[model samples]
Target: MPDPALLSIKDLHISVGSRPVIEGVSLDIAPGEMLGLVGESGCGKSVTALSIMRLLAEPPMHIDSGSIAFGGANVLDLDGPALEALRGDQIAMIFQEPMTSLNPVFTVGDQIAEVVTLHRAISREVAMARALELLGRVGIPTPDTALTRYPHQMSGGQRQRVMIAMALACDPQLLVADEPTTALDVTVQAQILDLLDDLRRETGMAVLLITHDLGVVSQYCDRVAVMYGGRIVEQAAASDLFAHPRHRYTEALLRTIPASNAPGTELPAIPGTVPPPGQRPSGCTFHPRCHAVVDACPRTMPELTGEPSSDSLLESRRMSLLELNHLSTTYPGAKGAVVQAVSDVSLDIAAGEVLGVVGESGCGKSTLGRTLLRLVEPSGGQILFDGKDLTALDRHQMKAVRRDLQVIFQDPFGSLNPRHSVGYIIGEPLIVHGVGDQASRDARVDELLALVGLPPDAGRRYPHEFSGGQRQRIAIARALALDPKLLVADEAVSALDVSIQSQIINLIAQLQKRLNLSILFISHDLSVIRHVSDRIAVMYLGRIVEIGPTETIMNKPQHPYTQALLSAIPRPGVARQKRVVLQGELPDPTKPPKGCAFHTRCPMVMDICHSVRPVLEHPTGSPTTGQVACHLYQDQA
Candidate 1:
């Protein structure tokens, strides 16, 4: 029998400049198994992957002591020439940002062919032919036509696919993928993920996937290694980690995920941010922000120990929400096309929920959010709010219903009128609804401002006078003015810094509990999505390809498109997905896919998939809330 473990990283100690980053870090990857190394940005996950390949820039990164053993040899000890031979021939890597990774002047096909030439003694013609074949395999459309195109000519997803083809050209035993899909669209993301899944199963090659998204690791990886600062704080089976997280950091990470089941309030985010490497505390690196931190946490760092495992989720994950018949709006083109943004798309939101919508520009996620609030004209489809059909209410008749509905838009600056002061901005809802008069509105605005943690005098400041975080607070306060039952946050906090992001997330979590408001939050940041969404709907060119409870969707995403979108989220560690480097921009929405919208660049495309549309239906092993539209899962055979 073959030894399952193919690569081992042991007691690695790495330092950059004058500070230590990775200390006593260790993990293993068996053949065909993926080990996800996850943490926030600037964590040591990237350094660890680079160290295995001996790629870190010297001086700043020095591996003082460590052992990276593969194929009975210590790769760390190998000299330049030996390491050079091992680099592309045995262990390969796909870095983040394909546009910059490739040589600007080289044709994409030539770049891939160059890798084949380096590892094997092959004629230029033969190598180029092999390059074309690999590109085709990676889902690049019209490989022959694309050979002459430079990296600049290809879209981000296409460029990434070229990078994958180059990495796979040598067929290395071990592959390290870093943020391979972060730049692609939701539909494209799903396709790339499915391709990675197919390739992993076929080659049985070990993959070290690095990312910040717990959802990605839960979906495509077998094992998980949680990172904090530069240390491996926890490691466990993917399912076990989700069901019963061991570390305090891991628990906090779980709470950060926004859930549709959670009423629209605030997300319980891990307080504070990842400290810069040099500023990391003396004892436990996570102590400053850990909610359960104790005195020992500030005095001694705890070793990662395996905890009791719960297999309940190992059998099957649970479903928390379901959307049956759904319809939204659409405006087809700049001219002739009728914009039926959302039509006949039924949706459901449940108890303890946070339902998320993800789509590229103009895919109707925002429109759908408005429709839920009856802010737009709905052409058709039943909307089940809890159990009631919300469309039945008449315009003036629904005035009472407006108190329960609230929305937060993408641009915090534009969303809040500049003419109004921060206090007035928030109190507008109270005044318009006649919930309170001048004195009462003033008092209520001050109360809401304090609830969001702003000072009482903040009411006197104009919208422009406050910072981005403060402006967002004003927006949140206004949304809360109605004391609503549901809220729709549309790209509400996309522009804030990472540290501020944590604060807002924490505030939202706190507010949700204080006021039970179901939220329809929408955004493009997958990292934020993994943390905030209880359930997610992946929209492509105006159709949801996959929808399910967050954990279920993250753990076993069925649609290739959903898989690709999840795979694209960037994290600090765990190698990235290789083959699913989706190679095309979203098809022009005006002229969508003839059948399956994703088929144009799908890796596992079938002839039938092009001729017939796949229905969004339930799969047997999926959670009840999970709905996917893909030919791969169909019972056609």
Candidate 2:
């Protein structure tokens, strides 16, 4: 006979106030298995996780119907003490944000000890010892001294580890981690995932990992459930789900990935955005954005039933608008020291090509974008636009060039003036550039709003009045107001939800094509970078460590830094593969390592890597167009 499910939800329904948020959701997880729950933001992924723990605030949320069975007991029917017992003893959950989950006033060790003391009936000293042990097990260095440190004193990765330790204090049979690694650096994410998998194997615990990153879901999850509009659109083994996703939403999500799309092609972004709660469409919620939508789709919902299969196919195939020749930017530090933000970074963006620069935070990805736009003055090297060296130009000359070299900053809220209407904000650029009179600028503003898919009347709305996606559209329209030839989009879509991110990505692609615009897209997200970039440059410690076509850099990464970054990406549906977990945080730019900056954490470091800098060059017999700055590839050439 087959083993019974460790946890099972049958026809679950949840309501928030008068609105239904989760409807007819059913899923199961077996013992010692990792199940992934995936969907875009506000798609009930976190709500589902909260439901499993019965952690929802009763006043605002209530389970209307359904049964949550755990180890033959209906968890929904458990009494207060019974539910309390079940919480830390049999089931534990790690919340999405560590900073918010943990109390700032409490020491991390004390927090974990509280869980242990509550559930285990252990003495304070014993619980404290247990907490320290857990901290050590979770890979925190100096676990002994770390016991006294508050959550605020720890780094993001360290704080997350504390949360995990607290959740595992009682050795619960089931662990629910909701977007545990979201917003974390790729290397830290890899480490956290590895620790979770290791702990699961050691303790024989089942893990339900809820995240929007399909790549992460592919690598760490054993079974997968694709959730949309409060329903399980599809569920299957990881391999089967990735191989052949039957649901159109799933298929669209898969196609939206950078790895799935070929370089220099338009990303296959799903149109529109996920409907707001209480506003979902009748019959099928995803019908509006689905490319496979039919007449029946809007009137009838389809059952998710299909066999899984795999397939692979590939198809192939610039006037220089902006160029950088060994461009460098530095800032004076506290004691005669200097912070190198961009170091001898030489690259170029063609007339209409997107050159994506990707790296971890503090790796100077944003600084490079700012440098190219001349927002940050270069300490050395040259910034050339249309064969004219920008560094040699005076402030007045550079100001004149600003009309054709615009920027879209990461935070649309801060970038856009909240006090001003969209019309005034966009027209301000035109006014500054002396492109048109007030009447002409107003007409141009309306035209620009239409170009970014906003309503003609949207110009009257303030920045705060629009949604995150809409605000981004406003930002785009403003950037296009001057008919800029080159645009610097620095982490433009990083703050948006996945579905909204796709829309903005598509909008950028459309604008690029329509305006014949050259773009310098800077972000820490490799998947998004791969999706929109013709060429990619991997940066580390203020230097371009690797540069190549998107496909070449992604598929055949020659630099160790590039390889580690790629390996750290969570590929949903693919089983856990060998990955290089980079050690330590990004080094202080003021005191960067003497040689190759990445050598501090690189897995394949050599003696020379510690003393001598490497030059970016193509490897011998590579047969691909790209460059790698690594000592390992030096011999290959």
Model 2 Cα lDDT, one tens digit per residue, 51-70: 88889999789999999999
Candidate 1 Cα misplacement greater than 4 A, ranges: 1-4, 260-263, 307-637
- 363-437, model 1: which lDDT tens digit per residue? 667787887777876777765553456678787757776766788776688888888788778888777778857
TM-score of 2: 0.51
lDDT of each: 0.75, 0.85
lDDT of 1 at 5: 53
RMSD, one per candidate, in order:
22.1, 23.5
Superposition error at 537 for model 2 (Å): 0.3
Cand. 1 TM to true fold = 0.49
